[model samples]
Target: MSIGERIKAKRKQSKLTQTELGKLVNVSSQVISNWERGYSDPNHDDVARLAVELDCSTEYLHGISGDKLSSKDVLVAGQEINLTTEELQLFNELKKHPVMFHDLASDPEKKVKELLKMYKMKKMFLEDDEELGDGFGDLED
Candidate 1:
């Protein structure tokens, strides 16, 4: 299907009016209409928002068969990073993994931070054989 058709389908599946979807994605209803009519396409930021709001991938929105941005290609705000398509594909694969979204969603940085903290906690607990209080465990649960 065309990107327009896919967008329409996603929007409908979300049970959102054009206006509502536009609001969520920060665009005007008429802009959404134009997109549905294939008159124009969303820019990268818009596409990113659309993918998030629709729970789909930018690649999918672009009519490419794949997942969203990869982990390595993603940089913390103020960090310099560049990502190739292949890296993005790998990132998407990681994002699609069963437990990966547990980190990808919410705060991606938080996910990494929690993982590191957990690793350290695990090492400390192992050394002392003590039960650590809830931290990353609580977030996952």
Candidate 2:
């Protein structure tokens, strides 16, 4: 299926009108129409927003993969903003091979679970520098 077709299907499946989807993604209804009609494709950022708002994978929208969400594999979607070295390591390793992180996420050990949780927290804070406040924001990315 084409990206436009997939976008239309997912949008309808999400029960969103073209205008509503446009608003969520910060585009005009006409832009959404253009995408749905195959007149133009969404840019990377728009695709990211669309996938998030439509609750589907960017790969799915692009027709690269049929799976909307893969349970066994981890996907680091969209662009990475302000990723720390450790966060990049975890993300890149998972992208290369899902085993290590899967093991860590599924591990019942308290420290392993907490480590995963902390990574998520740190990633969230770093994405928005304002959340870190003062000197904490600039930690040698």
Clash counts for the predictions, in order:
1, 0
lDDT of each: 0.70, 0.73
The most accurate candidate by TM-score is: 2
Cα deviation of 20 in candidate 1 (Å)?
0.4
Give the lowest summed-lDDT range of ten residues in model 2.
Answer: 71-80
User: Which parts of model 2 are misplaced by more than 4 Å?
Assistant: 70-74, 77-114, 117-141
Clashing pairs in 1: 70-91
RMSD in Å for all candidates = 12.0, 12.1
Summarize candidate 1's per-residue lDDT along 13-61 as a digit string, tens digits. 8899999999998899999999999998888999889988987767778
Pairs of colliding residues, candidate 2? none
Q: What TM-score does candidate 1 reach?
A: 0.51
* Model 2: lDDT of residue 125: 80
Give the least accurate 10-residue stretch of model 1, judged by summed lDDT: 71-80
